[model samples]
Target: MQWYLCALTALLLATGCKKTTCECPPKTDDPKMEYTELNDKAVGFNSSYSLDLNKDGEADFSFSTLLVGDPVLRRDYRQYYIVSKFYTNCLVNGNEETPVLQKGDKIGSLPPEGFHWYNASHVVIAQKIIEENGTSWSGNWKQVAHAYQPVSILKGDKTYYGWIELSFDMQSEKIILHRAAVAKDPNVEVKAGG
Candidate 1:
């Protein structure tokens, strides 16, 4: 068709006059950000990792691990908790479990199909239940490396989306946090570590 010639001509022109910036996604983001490098932290057995999600110098969420025993039920529970001091939410599939997202994956306020933004102050993740019969796990974070957790922070009148990179030590039920980042714009999707 005659349209093919026009398309070819347009493509040639675009190639001939290439701009300084390419139209493809960048390999890495150089965010003009305050929280560029995250502090290395771990929480286990009553100690908590207090987080300042927006890098505003105020603690927004506190993460801790707890071990509980129920003598009557002959079971023990090791749980990870995220307690928010402000309005904060995390991604979950409604099974009390947050998925382990990889690098470059999108972190958004609205989750895909089965997942949802967990709208609560206290969220229990990576729950490990031990019983005489066997041991079972919940919340996914066990043994994962460089994993990302999708998060949302609602401060004042706006909601900011972000992500936190984490790793879990199942032996000690410790949660190791490596990095955290927030999108420059409110309510926009951010790459896991960008």
Candidate 2:
């Protein structure tokens, strides 16, 4: 009786067993590039606009790419080393050194009402039309460049989570930059300059 009971249990267990398989996505060998710093070191600024000081519905920075960098996203793309701007009063230390703007550097105070564009310790007003006759591209998104305010230091991690958006408009011939609210670990700052 005992032997029969043991044999029956063994048979039932064998029939009820099912093979387990693991499904894992394939890992690519491609490297993940780190973001570079955007201080005076790894960045460059160049202004091409001619001033239309009268503001007759015209821009001052005109007819050229103000600043270009390695495409913002790529598997091999490295982080920016320094925050560089092509517009005047964009760089903190006049673009003379690397990492011109450091962490904890107090940017200027916000304006009383509308858009308050600024840099560290600078209340930036538009000096020239960075681009009057701007470039045009097609699609739902277009690219154009114009001078409005100076510029400010923006963290890189702030970019991925939709903190900053850079787009262009072909129909309007304008490059649009929108700054969004940031919520991230302050310790994970990207030092730009590479």
Candidate 3:
């Protein structure tokens, strides 16, 4: 009985001392994802691009810019003018709408009441040219107007943050997207002027 008891105790000790492997998998660093700089020209009066900031198969962000037009003139006189607008994939529609202002709306200005209920999910950030002809416009030139302000966008259940800077050169007939920053997830916040 003494021998059996000693053997049982040894077996229990050996079993307890055995190395156990953890079931959890090893953690790896996430892929290095960063914003991409884009320099594109507007097809007509507008240009759009779908961005996948996280390298995910699906597009996470979309940006569109339209030249603001005068309601009275019914046209955009400034060839280089652009108002950068950011949107999620959900808000974009296949149908076309007039880019100019309608009744009760102001020219070269967003709706005073803010985005309509249908467009509540969309966010707008304006960038005007700060300098022109090697001198500050003194708020005169709308072509280069730009404000590097951060705007929050709510799409579906997630909220994203980003900033955009738009510059157009009439001489070159090009619209330059100087900076764009979009968050991959709601928890992560993007800095301004990205």
Candidate 4:
């Protein structure tokens, strides 16, 4: 009886010392398993901006647009593409600042690149907003955006329009991307694209 008790105690100790086995499976970095949603209640604002004129302090006029297109999923198994256009208007604030306006140029195939940082100024951080799909299915959204700069300013009035494109797998669920672009000249009257 004493020998049997010793053996049982050793067996229990050995069992306890063994490594724990995962019940479900090792955690995977699966994009499909991850669902990200954009927070509709979130507010977006720009902090770093420049005044166009030497005197006026307030932003007379400013606006920006973020265009998200449907995913063009084809050929490439599970890949997706997102194309966005960032447009903004900067109006002269000073009384004497009568400005001439010019239409933005459309450079056929590709837009300009390399001179500026893609996404640096805007803040689109979210605490993770969730949405439900009926009883069993659900989907998520993420706010992905880009800050654009005016291509050319002829007179006093300047309008900026830029393009930003992003591609990712389902793993890019709800990834928040913010952008901000500082004018090259600090003193020049500057306004961020909306």
Candidate 3 ranges beyond 4 A from true positions: 1-33, 39-155, 187-189
Candidate No. with top TM-score? 1
Q: Find the 10 residues in a row with the least total lDDT in model 4.
A: 74-83
lDDT of 1 at 22: 65
Give the total clashing residue pairs for model 4: 14
Tens digit of per-residue lDDT, candidate 1, span 1-194 = 78999999999999998668768975765433324355558788678877786777877667887888999999999888776554787766756666678887877755766888766656676778999999987766767777887788886777788777888778867888887877666756677776
| Per-model CA lDDT versus the true structure | 0.74, 0.28, 0.40, 0.27
* Candidate 3 per-residue C-alpha lDDT over 89-108 given as tens digits, one digit per residue, 9 for 90 to 100: 22112221112221222211
What is the TM-score ranking, best to worst?
Answer: 1, 3, 2, 4
Worst lDDT 10-window in candidate 2: 36-45
Measured over all alpha carbons after superposition, the RMSD of each candidate to the real structure, in angstroms, is 8.7, 17.2, 13.5, 20.0
- Write the residue-wise lDDT of candidate 4 on 115-135 in tens digits: 231221232112222223311
Quote model 4's TM-score.
0.21
